[model samples]
Target: MKQVQKIKLGISIGDLNGIGSEIVLKTFDDSRMLDFCTPVIFASAKIITFLKKQYKLSLNFQGIDDPSKAIDGKINVMNVWKENVNINFGEEDPEVGKYAFLSLEAATAALKNDDIDVLVTAPINKSSIQSENFNFPGHTDYLARELEGESLMFMITDTLKIGLLTDHVALKDIASVITPELIQKKIDIIHETLKQDFRIQKPKIAVLGINPHSGDNGVIGKEDEEILKPTLHKIREKGKLVYGPYSADSFFGSKNYKNFDAVVASYHDQGLIPFKTLSFGNGVNFTAGLNKVRTSPDHGTAFEIAGTNSANINSFKEAVFKAIEIYKCRKEYRKLTQNALKKQGRKDTNKKLFTKDN
Candidate 1:
């Protein structure tokens, strides 16, 4: 019998003042989680210890200087910084935000280096995390620059999956930003992600309209009819199973979303509002179409409930599980594709030999 290798799950501790630390600790509190993957937390051991004592969690972690030293079946905390810092719960602090960026930066480096298999990030305060060095609106934008390929903010649960076409963009700019090219590119990304990451052979995708009743043939808004409908039509003509420009208002309410593998929304709120409503505590925000796998809980840093130790750990736990699943899926997809190409190569060779002899 052969022993299987465990995945190295890299974690980036988000805002120190938020429930990020609480959820991370609580999620791995159950020792059984270690059996699935080796968890490497990109934060100081002192901070985690402090958090454990504060949260009164029974979880134990080991300190390591690098991800390569991470041991399987143990919680590994890689110290990205070695300074004593103040932790003010339920408050937005720039100092704490800096630490969050440090953890994220270190974890991202390790991910790029393949030191870790997959990354499961905790929530960060978008406002507090703003600095000259880190000017991105959120994780998706930052990860898009750090990793290869176009990044799509894909929120996923067991049954529902939604991708945003224009994430982190203002509502006013959304209409103007959403062009035929942008729609086509996002559709391509979602289509490939479905087949490669989710292992869907032929994925059927739904695109929500930009306006009410999908603009009612240019009544409510011309964007839906002029841009969205035309773009989707062109994509469908390419023989891909893409459908929509459906009215967003009743798309999920009527359970029309259940018919497709995934749904593409025009903007952030348009997609996230419904997704979070349907699967708030259980949904995982997966950054799809990237070279590396990364996932985070659907919810953000709950500042009001930061230090109460009452933060729900379900989303974070689901994030960890989803990251591992996606990593394995990508690996398996690559192997199958390679084998298929090899078989085709052999067939082509045999045909050439037979043709030459005949």
Candidate 2:
């Protein structure tokens, strides 16, 4: 395979007290990661040094003040803030939360200005990260607001991709939000993301029902029949290959998701419960349908084992690679579209010239 240009990945260290800095350092500790992309970590050098000492891991990184000064083949730490905040491992403190926000806010701004090609965020403590400035469920919701796009939380790995129709909502409110319009919109966004981000020409998507047994022909629930079925029908009529209000239990149990390009669930747990159960250590939470590329590890801030050096870096590694691949795919897709349009324009001009002469 030919090599593509390296992407500049802007990483936001999630919660300072957690394993965010740990995974980021571990992932880039291998010099081979730099061969594919340049890494700009939105963190302070002091924080990374503290984590290294706590975890007893020897890692070196270059510190830079701006993304433009990032050096390839070396881990570059963009010092977002100079605060001397304390790291309370295994505890959530407001001061740690404040630093997390500062790092995230800076990284997000760099993303908006195209200073970075992609954004790969570390795990964040949702409760601690919440403040008057950053009051959101998680990175998915925050990115949706910052980047100005209806983002879909897509879990990705080597095989099987899963998306959620409703994310970060209560189970009690799941039924109310499972409307036909919302289902169709989520599926549409998933379809577009599959094509442009994954380079799938004609994507096949599977949608799970809101009820068990897919409502059992209105026995379990009517939403699957009255709302979901019709919506899938309309999507298919428009030349898209979409299937299923498949029962959540049997769908993953029988491994039916193997046959589809991507799967959409009615709510959060309906999708994530299965995806994580199957591919937790290596899965990536990709924010699809966003104008900018953003991805994160499937797991969150593991406060229980924050500085134990037990944090698995596979998911975080996969997140970085996934963001790079998606960025390349989108660029290639745009180039192909532009070339086709130019060809069509030339052909039309020639046809007009020939007709006038004849």
lDDT of 2 at 138: 88
What is candidate 2's CA lDDT for residue 64? 89
Off by over 4 Å in 2: 1-5, 355-358
Candidate 2 has its poorest 10 consecutive residues by lDDT at 50-59
Q: Which of the numbered candidates is closest to the native, going by highest TM-score?
A: 1
Using lDDT, give the best candidate's number. 1
**Candidate 1 all-Cα RMSD:** 1.0
Q: Across residues 150-225, which tens digit of lDDT does each residue of candidate 1 receive?
A: 9999999989999999999989898999999999899899998898889898999999999888889998989997
lDDT of each: 0.93, 0.89
Model 2 per-residue lDDT tens digits across residues 171-267 = 9999898887888778889999898899899999998988998899999878888988998999899999999889899899998999999999888
